[model samples]
Target: MIIEEIYQSYLNFLKEFTAFKSISTDPAFATDIANTARWLQDQLAANGFKTEFITGYDNPLVVGSYIVDPKLKTILIYGHYDVQPPYAKASEGQARMIEEDLWKAEGWENDPFVLTEKNGRLVARGAVDNKGQIALHLTTVFELIKQKKLNYNIKFLIEGNEETGSPNLRHFIEDHADLLSCDSVLISDGEIASGHPVIEVGFRGVINTAITLTTSDRDLHSGLYGGSVPNAARELMKLIEKLYQGTTTIAIDDFYDDVIAPTKEELKNHASFPFSIEHHHRVTGTKKLFSENSLDFYTQTGLRPSIEITGFESGYNGVGFKNAVPHTASAKLNIRIVPNQDPKKTVKQFEAFVKNNTPSYATVTLQLGQGCKPIRINPKSELATKAAKLLTQEFNKKVLYKYCAATIPIVIDFKEILGVSQVLLPFGNEDCNMHGANENFEIDLIKKDIGVAWGLLS
Candidate 1:
């Protein structure tokens, strides 16, 4: 009945919340980010939360606290306000040359910044990724406070730079340790595996970087200088080809030497999870599985490391042929690391590998971003057990312990800086299409998240 009562109001709130293009990666949306932060603060304050803006950073962080009593246990909720760019930008030596509209190219039926409902689904940029989840929690808190049923001290740290890897997160956590200290932390950002409710026990870490190869100052005519000069694109392509040895293993030295394998019990639990190969194919649009030594999906993602090429820009790709040789070529890469692997050391190894493999005529440069360590939470912790029980009751099915392949940089910061137990309850559907065009969420899952939030906070 509570879910039914709050459906319309929650949908309205989500529509307003998702309209802001609070993209943290690009400075062109600074005003939009500020507006979003203010909107969050005002909403929390209206719902009886004492709110403050954590500033002096790249993007402001919104913290809201609702304390009933000092003796009560505190629950800190973390979510990001930032959404990835609606389109990808092609850059040439740090200068963005083209802003390609991926939304249109990907065949989005509605405006990405406008929340649209079609066939019982909400479509918008960040609808399910983070804004929708954050909106659901806030609406649940509003209802709980109205019904006078909240029992725990609730604190929300809604940040603005998660899409770009939270560069200022470490400093923020260190400076506000006392303010963020809590008995437990709750996060709802990722998707449920195969639409089944899951308690994510661990997640892989990640680092994003770009490698640029420069052979000359300007684009050269391929017809005049085809074999006389070095082609940056060709040289960079050869370098990238050496990044891996076989199909699954990275060729970089010691890349996979530091990963910790899952235990027997953990493997057993993964085998029992409700996984469907058909569902995996439906979501990924591929019929084959790329795993190491023919491992299962869980083992491949949760237990192993991966190197992915996210973006590449070189030469002329236009309506017509330019017949020019590109002077510079750049490739963006994302490396997923497992537990016990140090990010700094891994970056060094990656750098050395590139340098050794690169051609002598070309000059290579590496631009690195922030790195996050992997996290493994105890599945049997008191808070985790409680969450499992609540999730089972809500979804009317047994809860699964998931080893998430994706990374959330702030989760590890919460664990290390606040020293609190954490519970990750995923509420989005597997086909939510986060960080991509036509990103959407199901109305059913939105209601389910509100119900779960009520149970947790109460």
Candidate 2:
């Protein structure tokens, strides 16, 4: 069987892939990112893929293709070669020291970056969130080629910008339409919703904005005009609090105008899923839960729209109290939008609401950030159904089909531009610490995930 061989090869590839600090945000890692791309290109070439590097303004995309039978279906596999920024500066040295101490206390058998086999887990960055997935797909194709088992065409588009919101992927896909044309696409960048096998069928869109409130031209001493002058900080807080007052529902007019209700079938499926509210609270370390309505907590987080205040900043944050009316105050907010809701339209409505409600003495400025449309895929596609059956057969577990609250903008672009349905089969755990400190992937999952991908292709 190709399973054992594929597992060993994945380990070898992961060790090398994780060693390169392909941090996308830092210009210092430019060469590292390019090197990672080249390495992936070489692997594709060796596996009989007609491969080339599509050079970007900053990073390069590794594109490869193979044709088996013109009549056979074509599947495009997508993954990223870039990794999130790592903490390596002197200011973070103390934190690293503390982390090392903690790792020791936890009795970690091997180094986090190195491919260490302890008990059963493979400890390393990129082991599960992407590099391992990429390696698995590549190795599966390689094994098929070696055994002459491939019966369909495959195209691989490994990018280096997914960690940075995939800003340039749309242009690259548009420019290379002919190369990426396929009947379907598969993405391995998501996770199992509740640590069980799952096939994510949809993802929520996102809209981020910064709200700034300005009052006086300069700071004013509270003693000089304590009761007369307006405070921008207090005004900003008032505007923000208007989002969720007394209840959890946002007070913005028409905020839920475009939200589509979940179907009866979807609601039934969610109710049958093996989700535990107590487990969720324990895992998140939350003391309480509150919402406008009394619904299943999982339904609210997975299917409902949410608005959050991510950060707030104002005047006079010092060692002691300044007691001043600040000139300006700002808060960063993000909204996870559901399907049928237009981010631009939502932003316009929010702006109008703020303008109409702002007090006469204060001014509110709304700045819109990146936004993406929600995407849903047919759960009954041949590829998805076949993969689901294979996963259940192999793992002896029921696979859950659900939509994720997080956003992946390119999924919509792929559907619109390439006319391809994408399937999300995440092998990582929910608490994999993706995009956070001490991020690590379980080694056992990495091994079994290779088997899962191979089984899907077979």
Candidate 3:
């Protein structure tokens, strides 16, 4: 009855938050984005927080402060109000449209903009990543304020454009550093692994780029030129084959030059966590895993660097073959770099590697996107240790320190700009399906996360 009542109260707020459809990447949703920001400001203002709008960026940022005492320790909370659009047009540079119909095709059971409960999970677009977390945190803070149990000054820096690479977040921090100054930061934007508590200590950097190869000016008749001339598709396939040594390591020269291996202590801690290769295969629907005999999943994904060919196109992929050779072939590359590795420098190295490996007949072009550097927090910090112990007690499991193989560009900005210690706690479940349809957060998990927040803040 208590959780149900709390859920009902939080549900009212979450419903209002999720109804805005704050998809920041699309211009059509600009009004919705602004509305969402204003709505959040109102919520904070109503809860006795001194709320204001931080601007001069693509999307306005809602900042809410509740200072218990000027001399007390401060913890700034960061979350986003934006949700990914239900679909993306091809003109957006995507290979295909992400149709909303696919939500139902993928077993989505409720309207993405409506917060609904099914099987003890709250489902909505930003349910877990991260409007749900925002609501949960606000609820905790509200209770704390009501009970006069606050010990630390609280600040909420809720942004609206995180899904779009946080283009102006660094500048926002730079412009308002004094207003945003804090002793530490609290984040619940990630998820727990295998139902266990996690303090995500680090995340890999990222380089997004595209590689295009041109073999000829136009498509040639495959029947006549199949054997006489180089097929762009075949050439590109050859280059791709050389990108990897076997199935595990990248073939690029010095690709691992700056990668820092897991420490003995980190490995020992990682080994204690539970993992199942069978479950991984079943969940991912993969035939097999890479280097399973040698590298553990966490080591490969978290500690190591990897290259993924996210999109590839060369020849005809239609109902029937065109019976011609493709003149141009392009592949999208998403490179994940580790700590100590410079994303820009790594892209340069990758460019050189691709060009050098291409055949003389083929010409190559590289188009680069923004690069985000990897970040590692001090897992042994006093705050982190204390939070980890609290989480372990709350979850009744040994808290695991996770090195996420993903990129949160703003997290890096927080370290470089704010220069404060961070507690990277994850409050959602592993199968919350973040960024996908039917996104949801477990009810019990929210209760647990609020308890953890109460413990940390109190």
Candidate 4:
């Protein structure tokens, strides 16, 4: 295949796809997601593959399959069509117009939704995470098929709800196991911590919890009950504090009991990365590190378990201070667990801890939300070795292997139902500003990723 022609076609398709604002969070973009899925299905069909739409509760999954040889290894290429909402709010003055705030910035040099080539960078939303990556996979397969370069069967599982924790992906996977059965899965959705081409071997799981504590029926005058009543806000704070004893490790019982320590080789490979504790703090603009042992920060983030307090609410906030004790206090928390730690067991332990620690006067309520299990694949798997070798050959740099902190629910479900492992090969940078204002992707990286995909297929 002519590399130049393939790269140009890939870029054109990327721009056209990125123009559609398929924001999964907004109901307004429901049609847009469907349109994108239709376009993708058409593209896959045009490439000489059997295609079908796996309808779900919200958006559907676009699946396409091609069999080169029944005996050849089958690979599942998974990606998402949904994107996070843009930051172009009409209320933010001057930022409303696409040319003004949407475009022209140090990192963002053009409209995030409109593709622009500036300083050899492609500025657009989903350019890298992950419309561009998805396009790369598609173009790679298409070009190979066109040139008769492919030698194995390929299955595409493009989902539309990955951004929202893949609410329906588990059921989809279970229902379509025969259709999606494959030797392995390749996902281009995560990035290397070192900002280099790498294969993600593992991903952490998450358990979200909402806790509410009520001490009284309604707000009470602080002066009248200052000495007698137990403040709900104070009690809630105590409960939360007990979960984190001024240390990075969570204080919840048995939280780490099921955590599987990294292998000796995995730890050695992690140490090979040139990560400076001081430089990380400087880049984050923090005066001090969170972990007691500064060297443990990387482990805590990449391999260890953690509890995070996402939000908290209590009492009133106005011009003047209201002298009243809050009747109810609530907090939102997310606990990230490592491999071997079941999300259900972790949540149960957390609830039990809160119940045992709560005062008799205060009633505690625990609401469990979404939960998923952590996943880790062998670094020496045949597919992983092949991908790493191809990435090194294409990029002329050693491939970095790292664990992603975020959760991809479908990955776990795919493994459980289909018995497949996914390789996360992300083309996006760390500071892509996803789910934030002025999200942008480097144009040069987009082109390079196309080449990388081509090389991987080769």
How far residue 280's Cα lies from its native spot in candidate 3, in Å, is: 2.3
Model 1, 161-225: lDDT tens per residue?
99889888988999999888789998989888766788898889999999999999999999999
Off by over 4 Å in 4: 1-4, 26-29, 69-71, 86-112, 116-120, 215-235, 278-287, 292-297, 313-329
- Residue 427 shift from truth in candidate 2, angstroms: 1.5
lDDT assessment of candidate 1: 0.86
Top candidate by lDDT: 1
TM-score: which is higher, 1 or 2? Answer: 1
90-188: candidate 4 lDDT, tens digit per residue? 333443355455434334555667877665666677876678778888988998999888867999999888777777788777777899999988888
Clashes of each: 0, 1, 0, 2
Candidate 2 ranges with C-alpha deviation above 4 Å: 25-31, 56-58, 69-71, 86-125, 216-234, 290-292, 314-326, 357-365
Clashing pairs in 1: none
TM-score of each: 0.96, 0.84, 0.89, 0.83
**Prediction 2 TM-score vs. true:** 0.84
Ranking by lDDT: 1, 3, 4, 2
Q: Which residue pairs overlap in candidate 4's backbone?
A: 121-443, 122-443
lDDT of 2 by residue, 1-458 (tens): 56777777777878888777677867878998989999988888987889989886358998899988889899998988787654443232244466455444444444445655544655555666577677778888888878777766899988887766677788888888888999889888866756578888788888888899999799999899877888888889988887875655777888888888878888788777786767667656677776546755555666677889977888876455788888899998988888888888888877888888888888788888657877787878888888898778766788998787787777988988998777888777666666654456666666667777877775
lDDT of 3: 0.84
* Cα lDDT, model 1, residue 381: 74
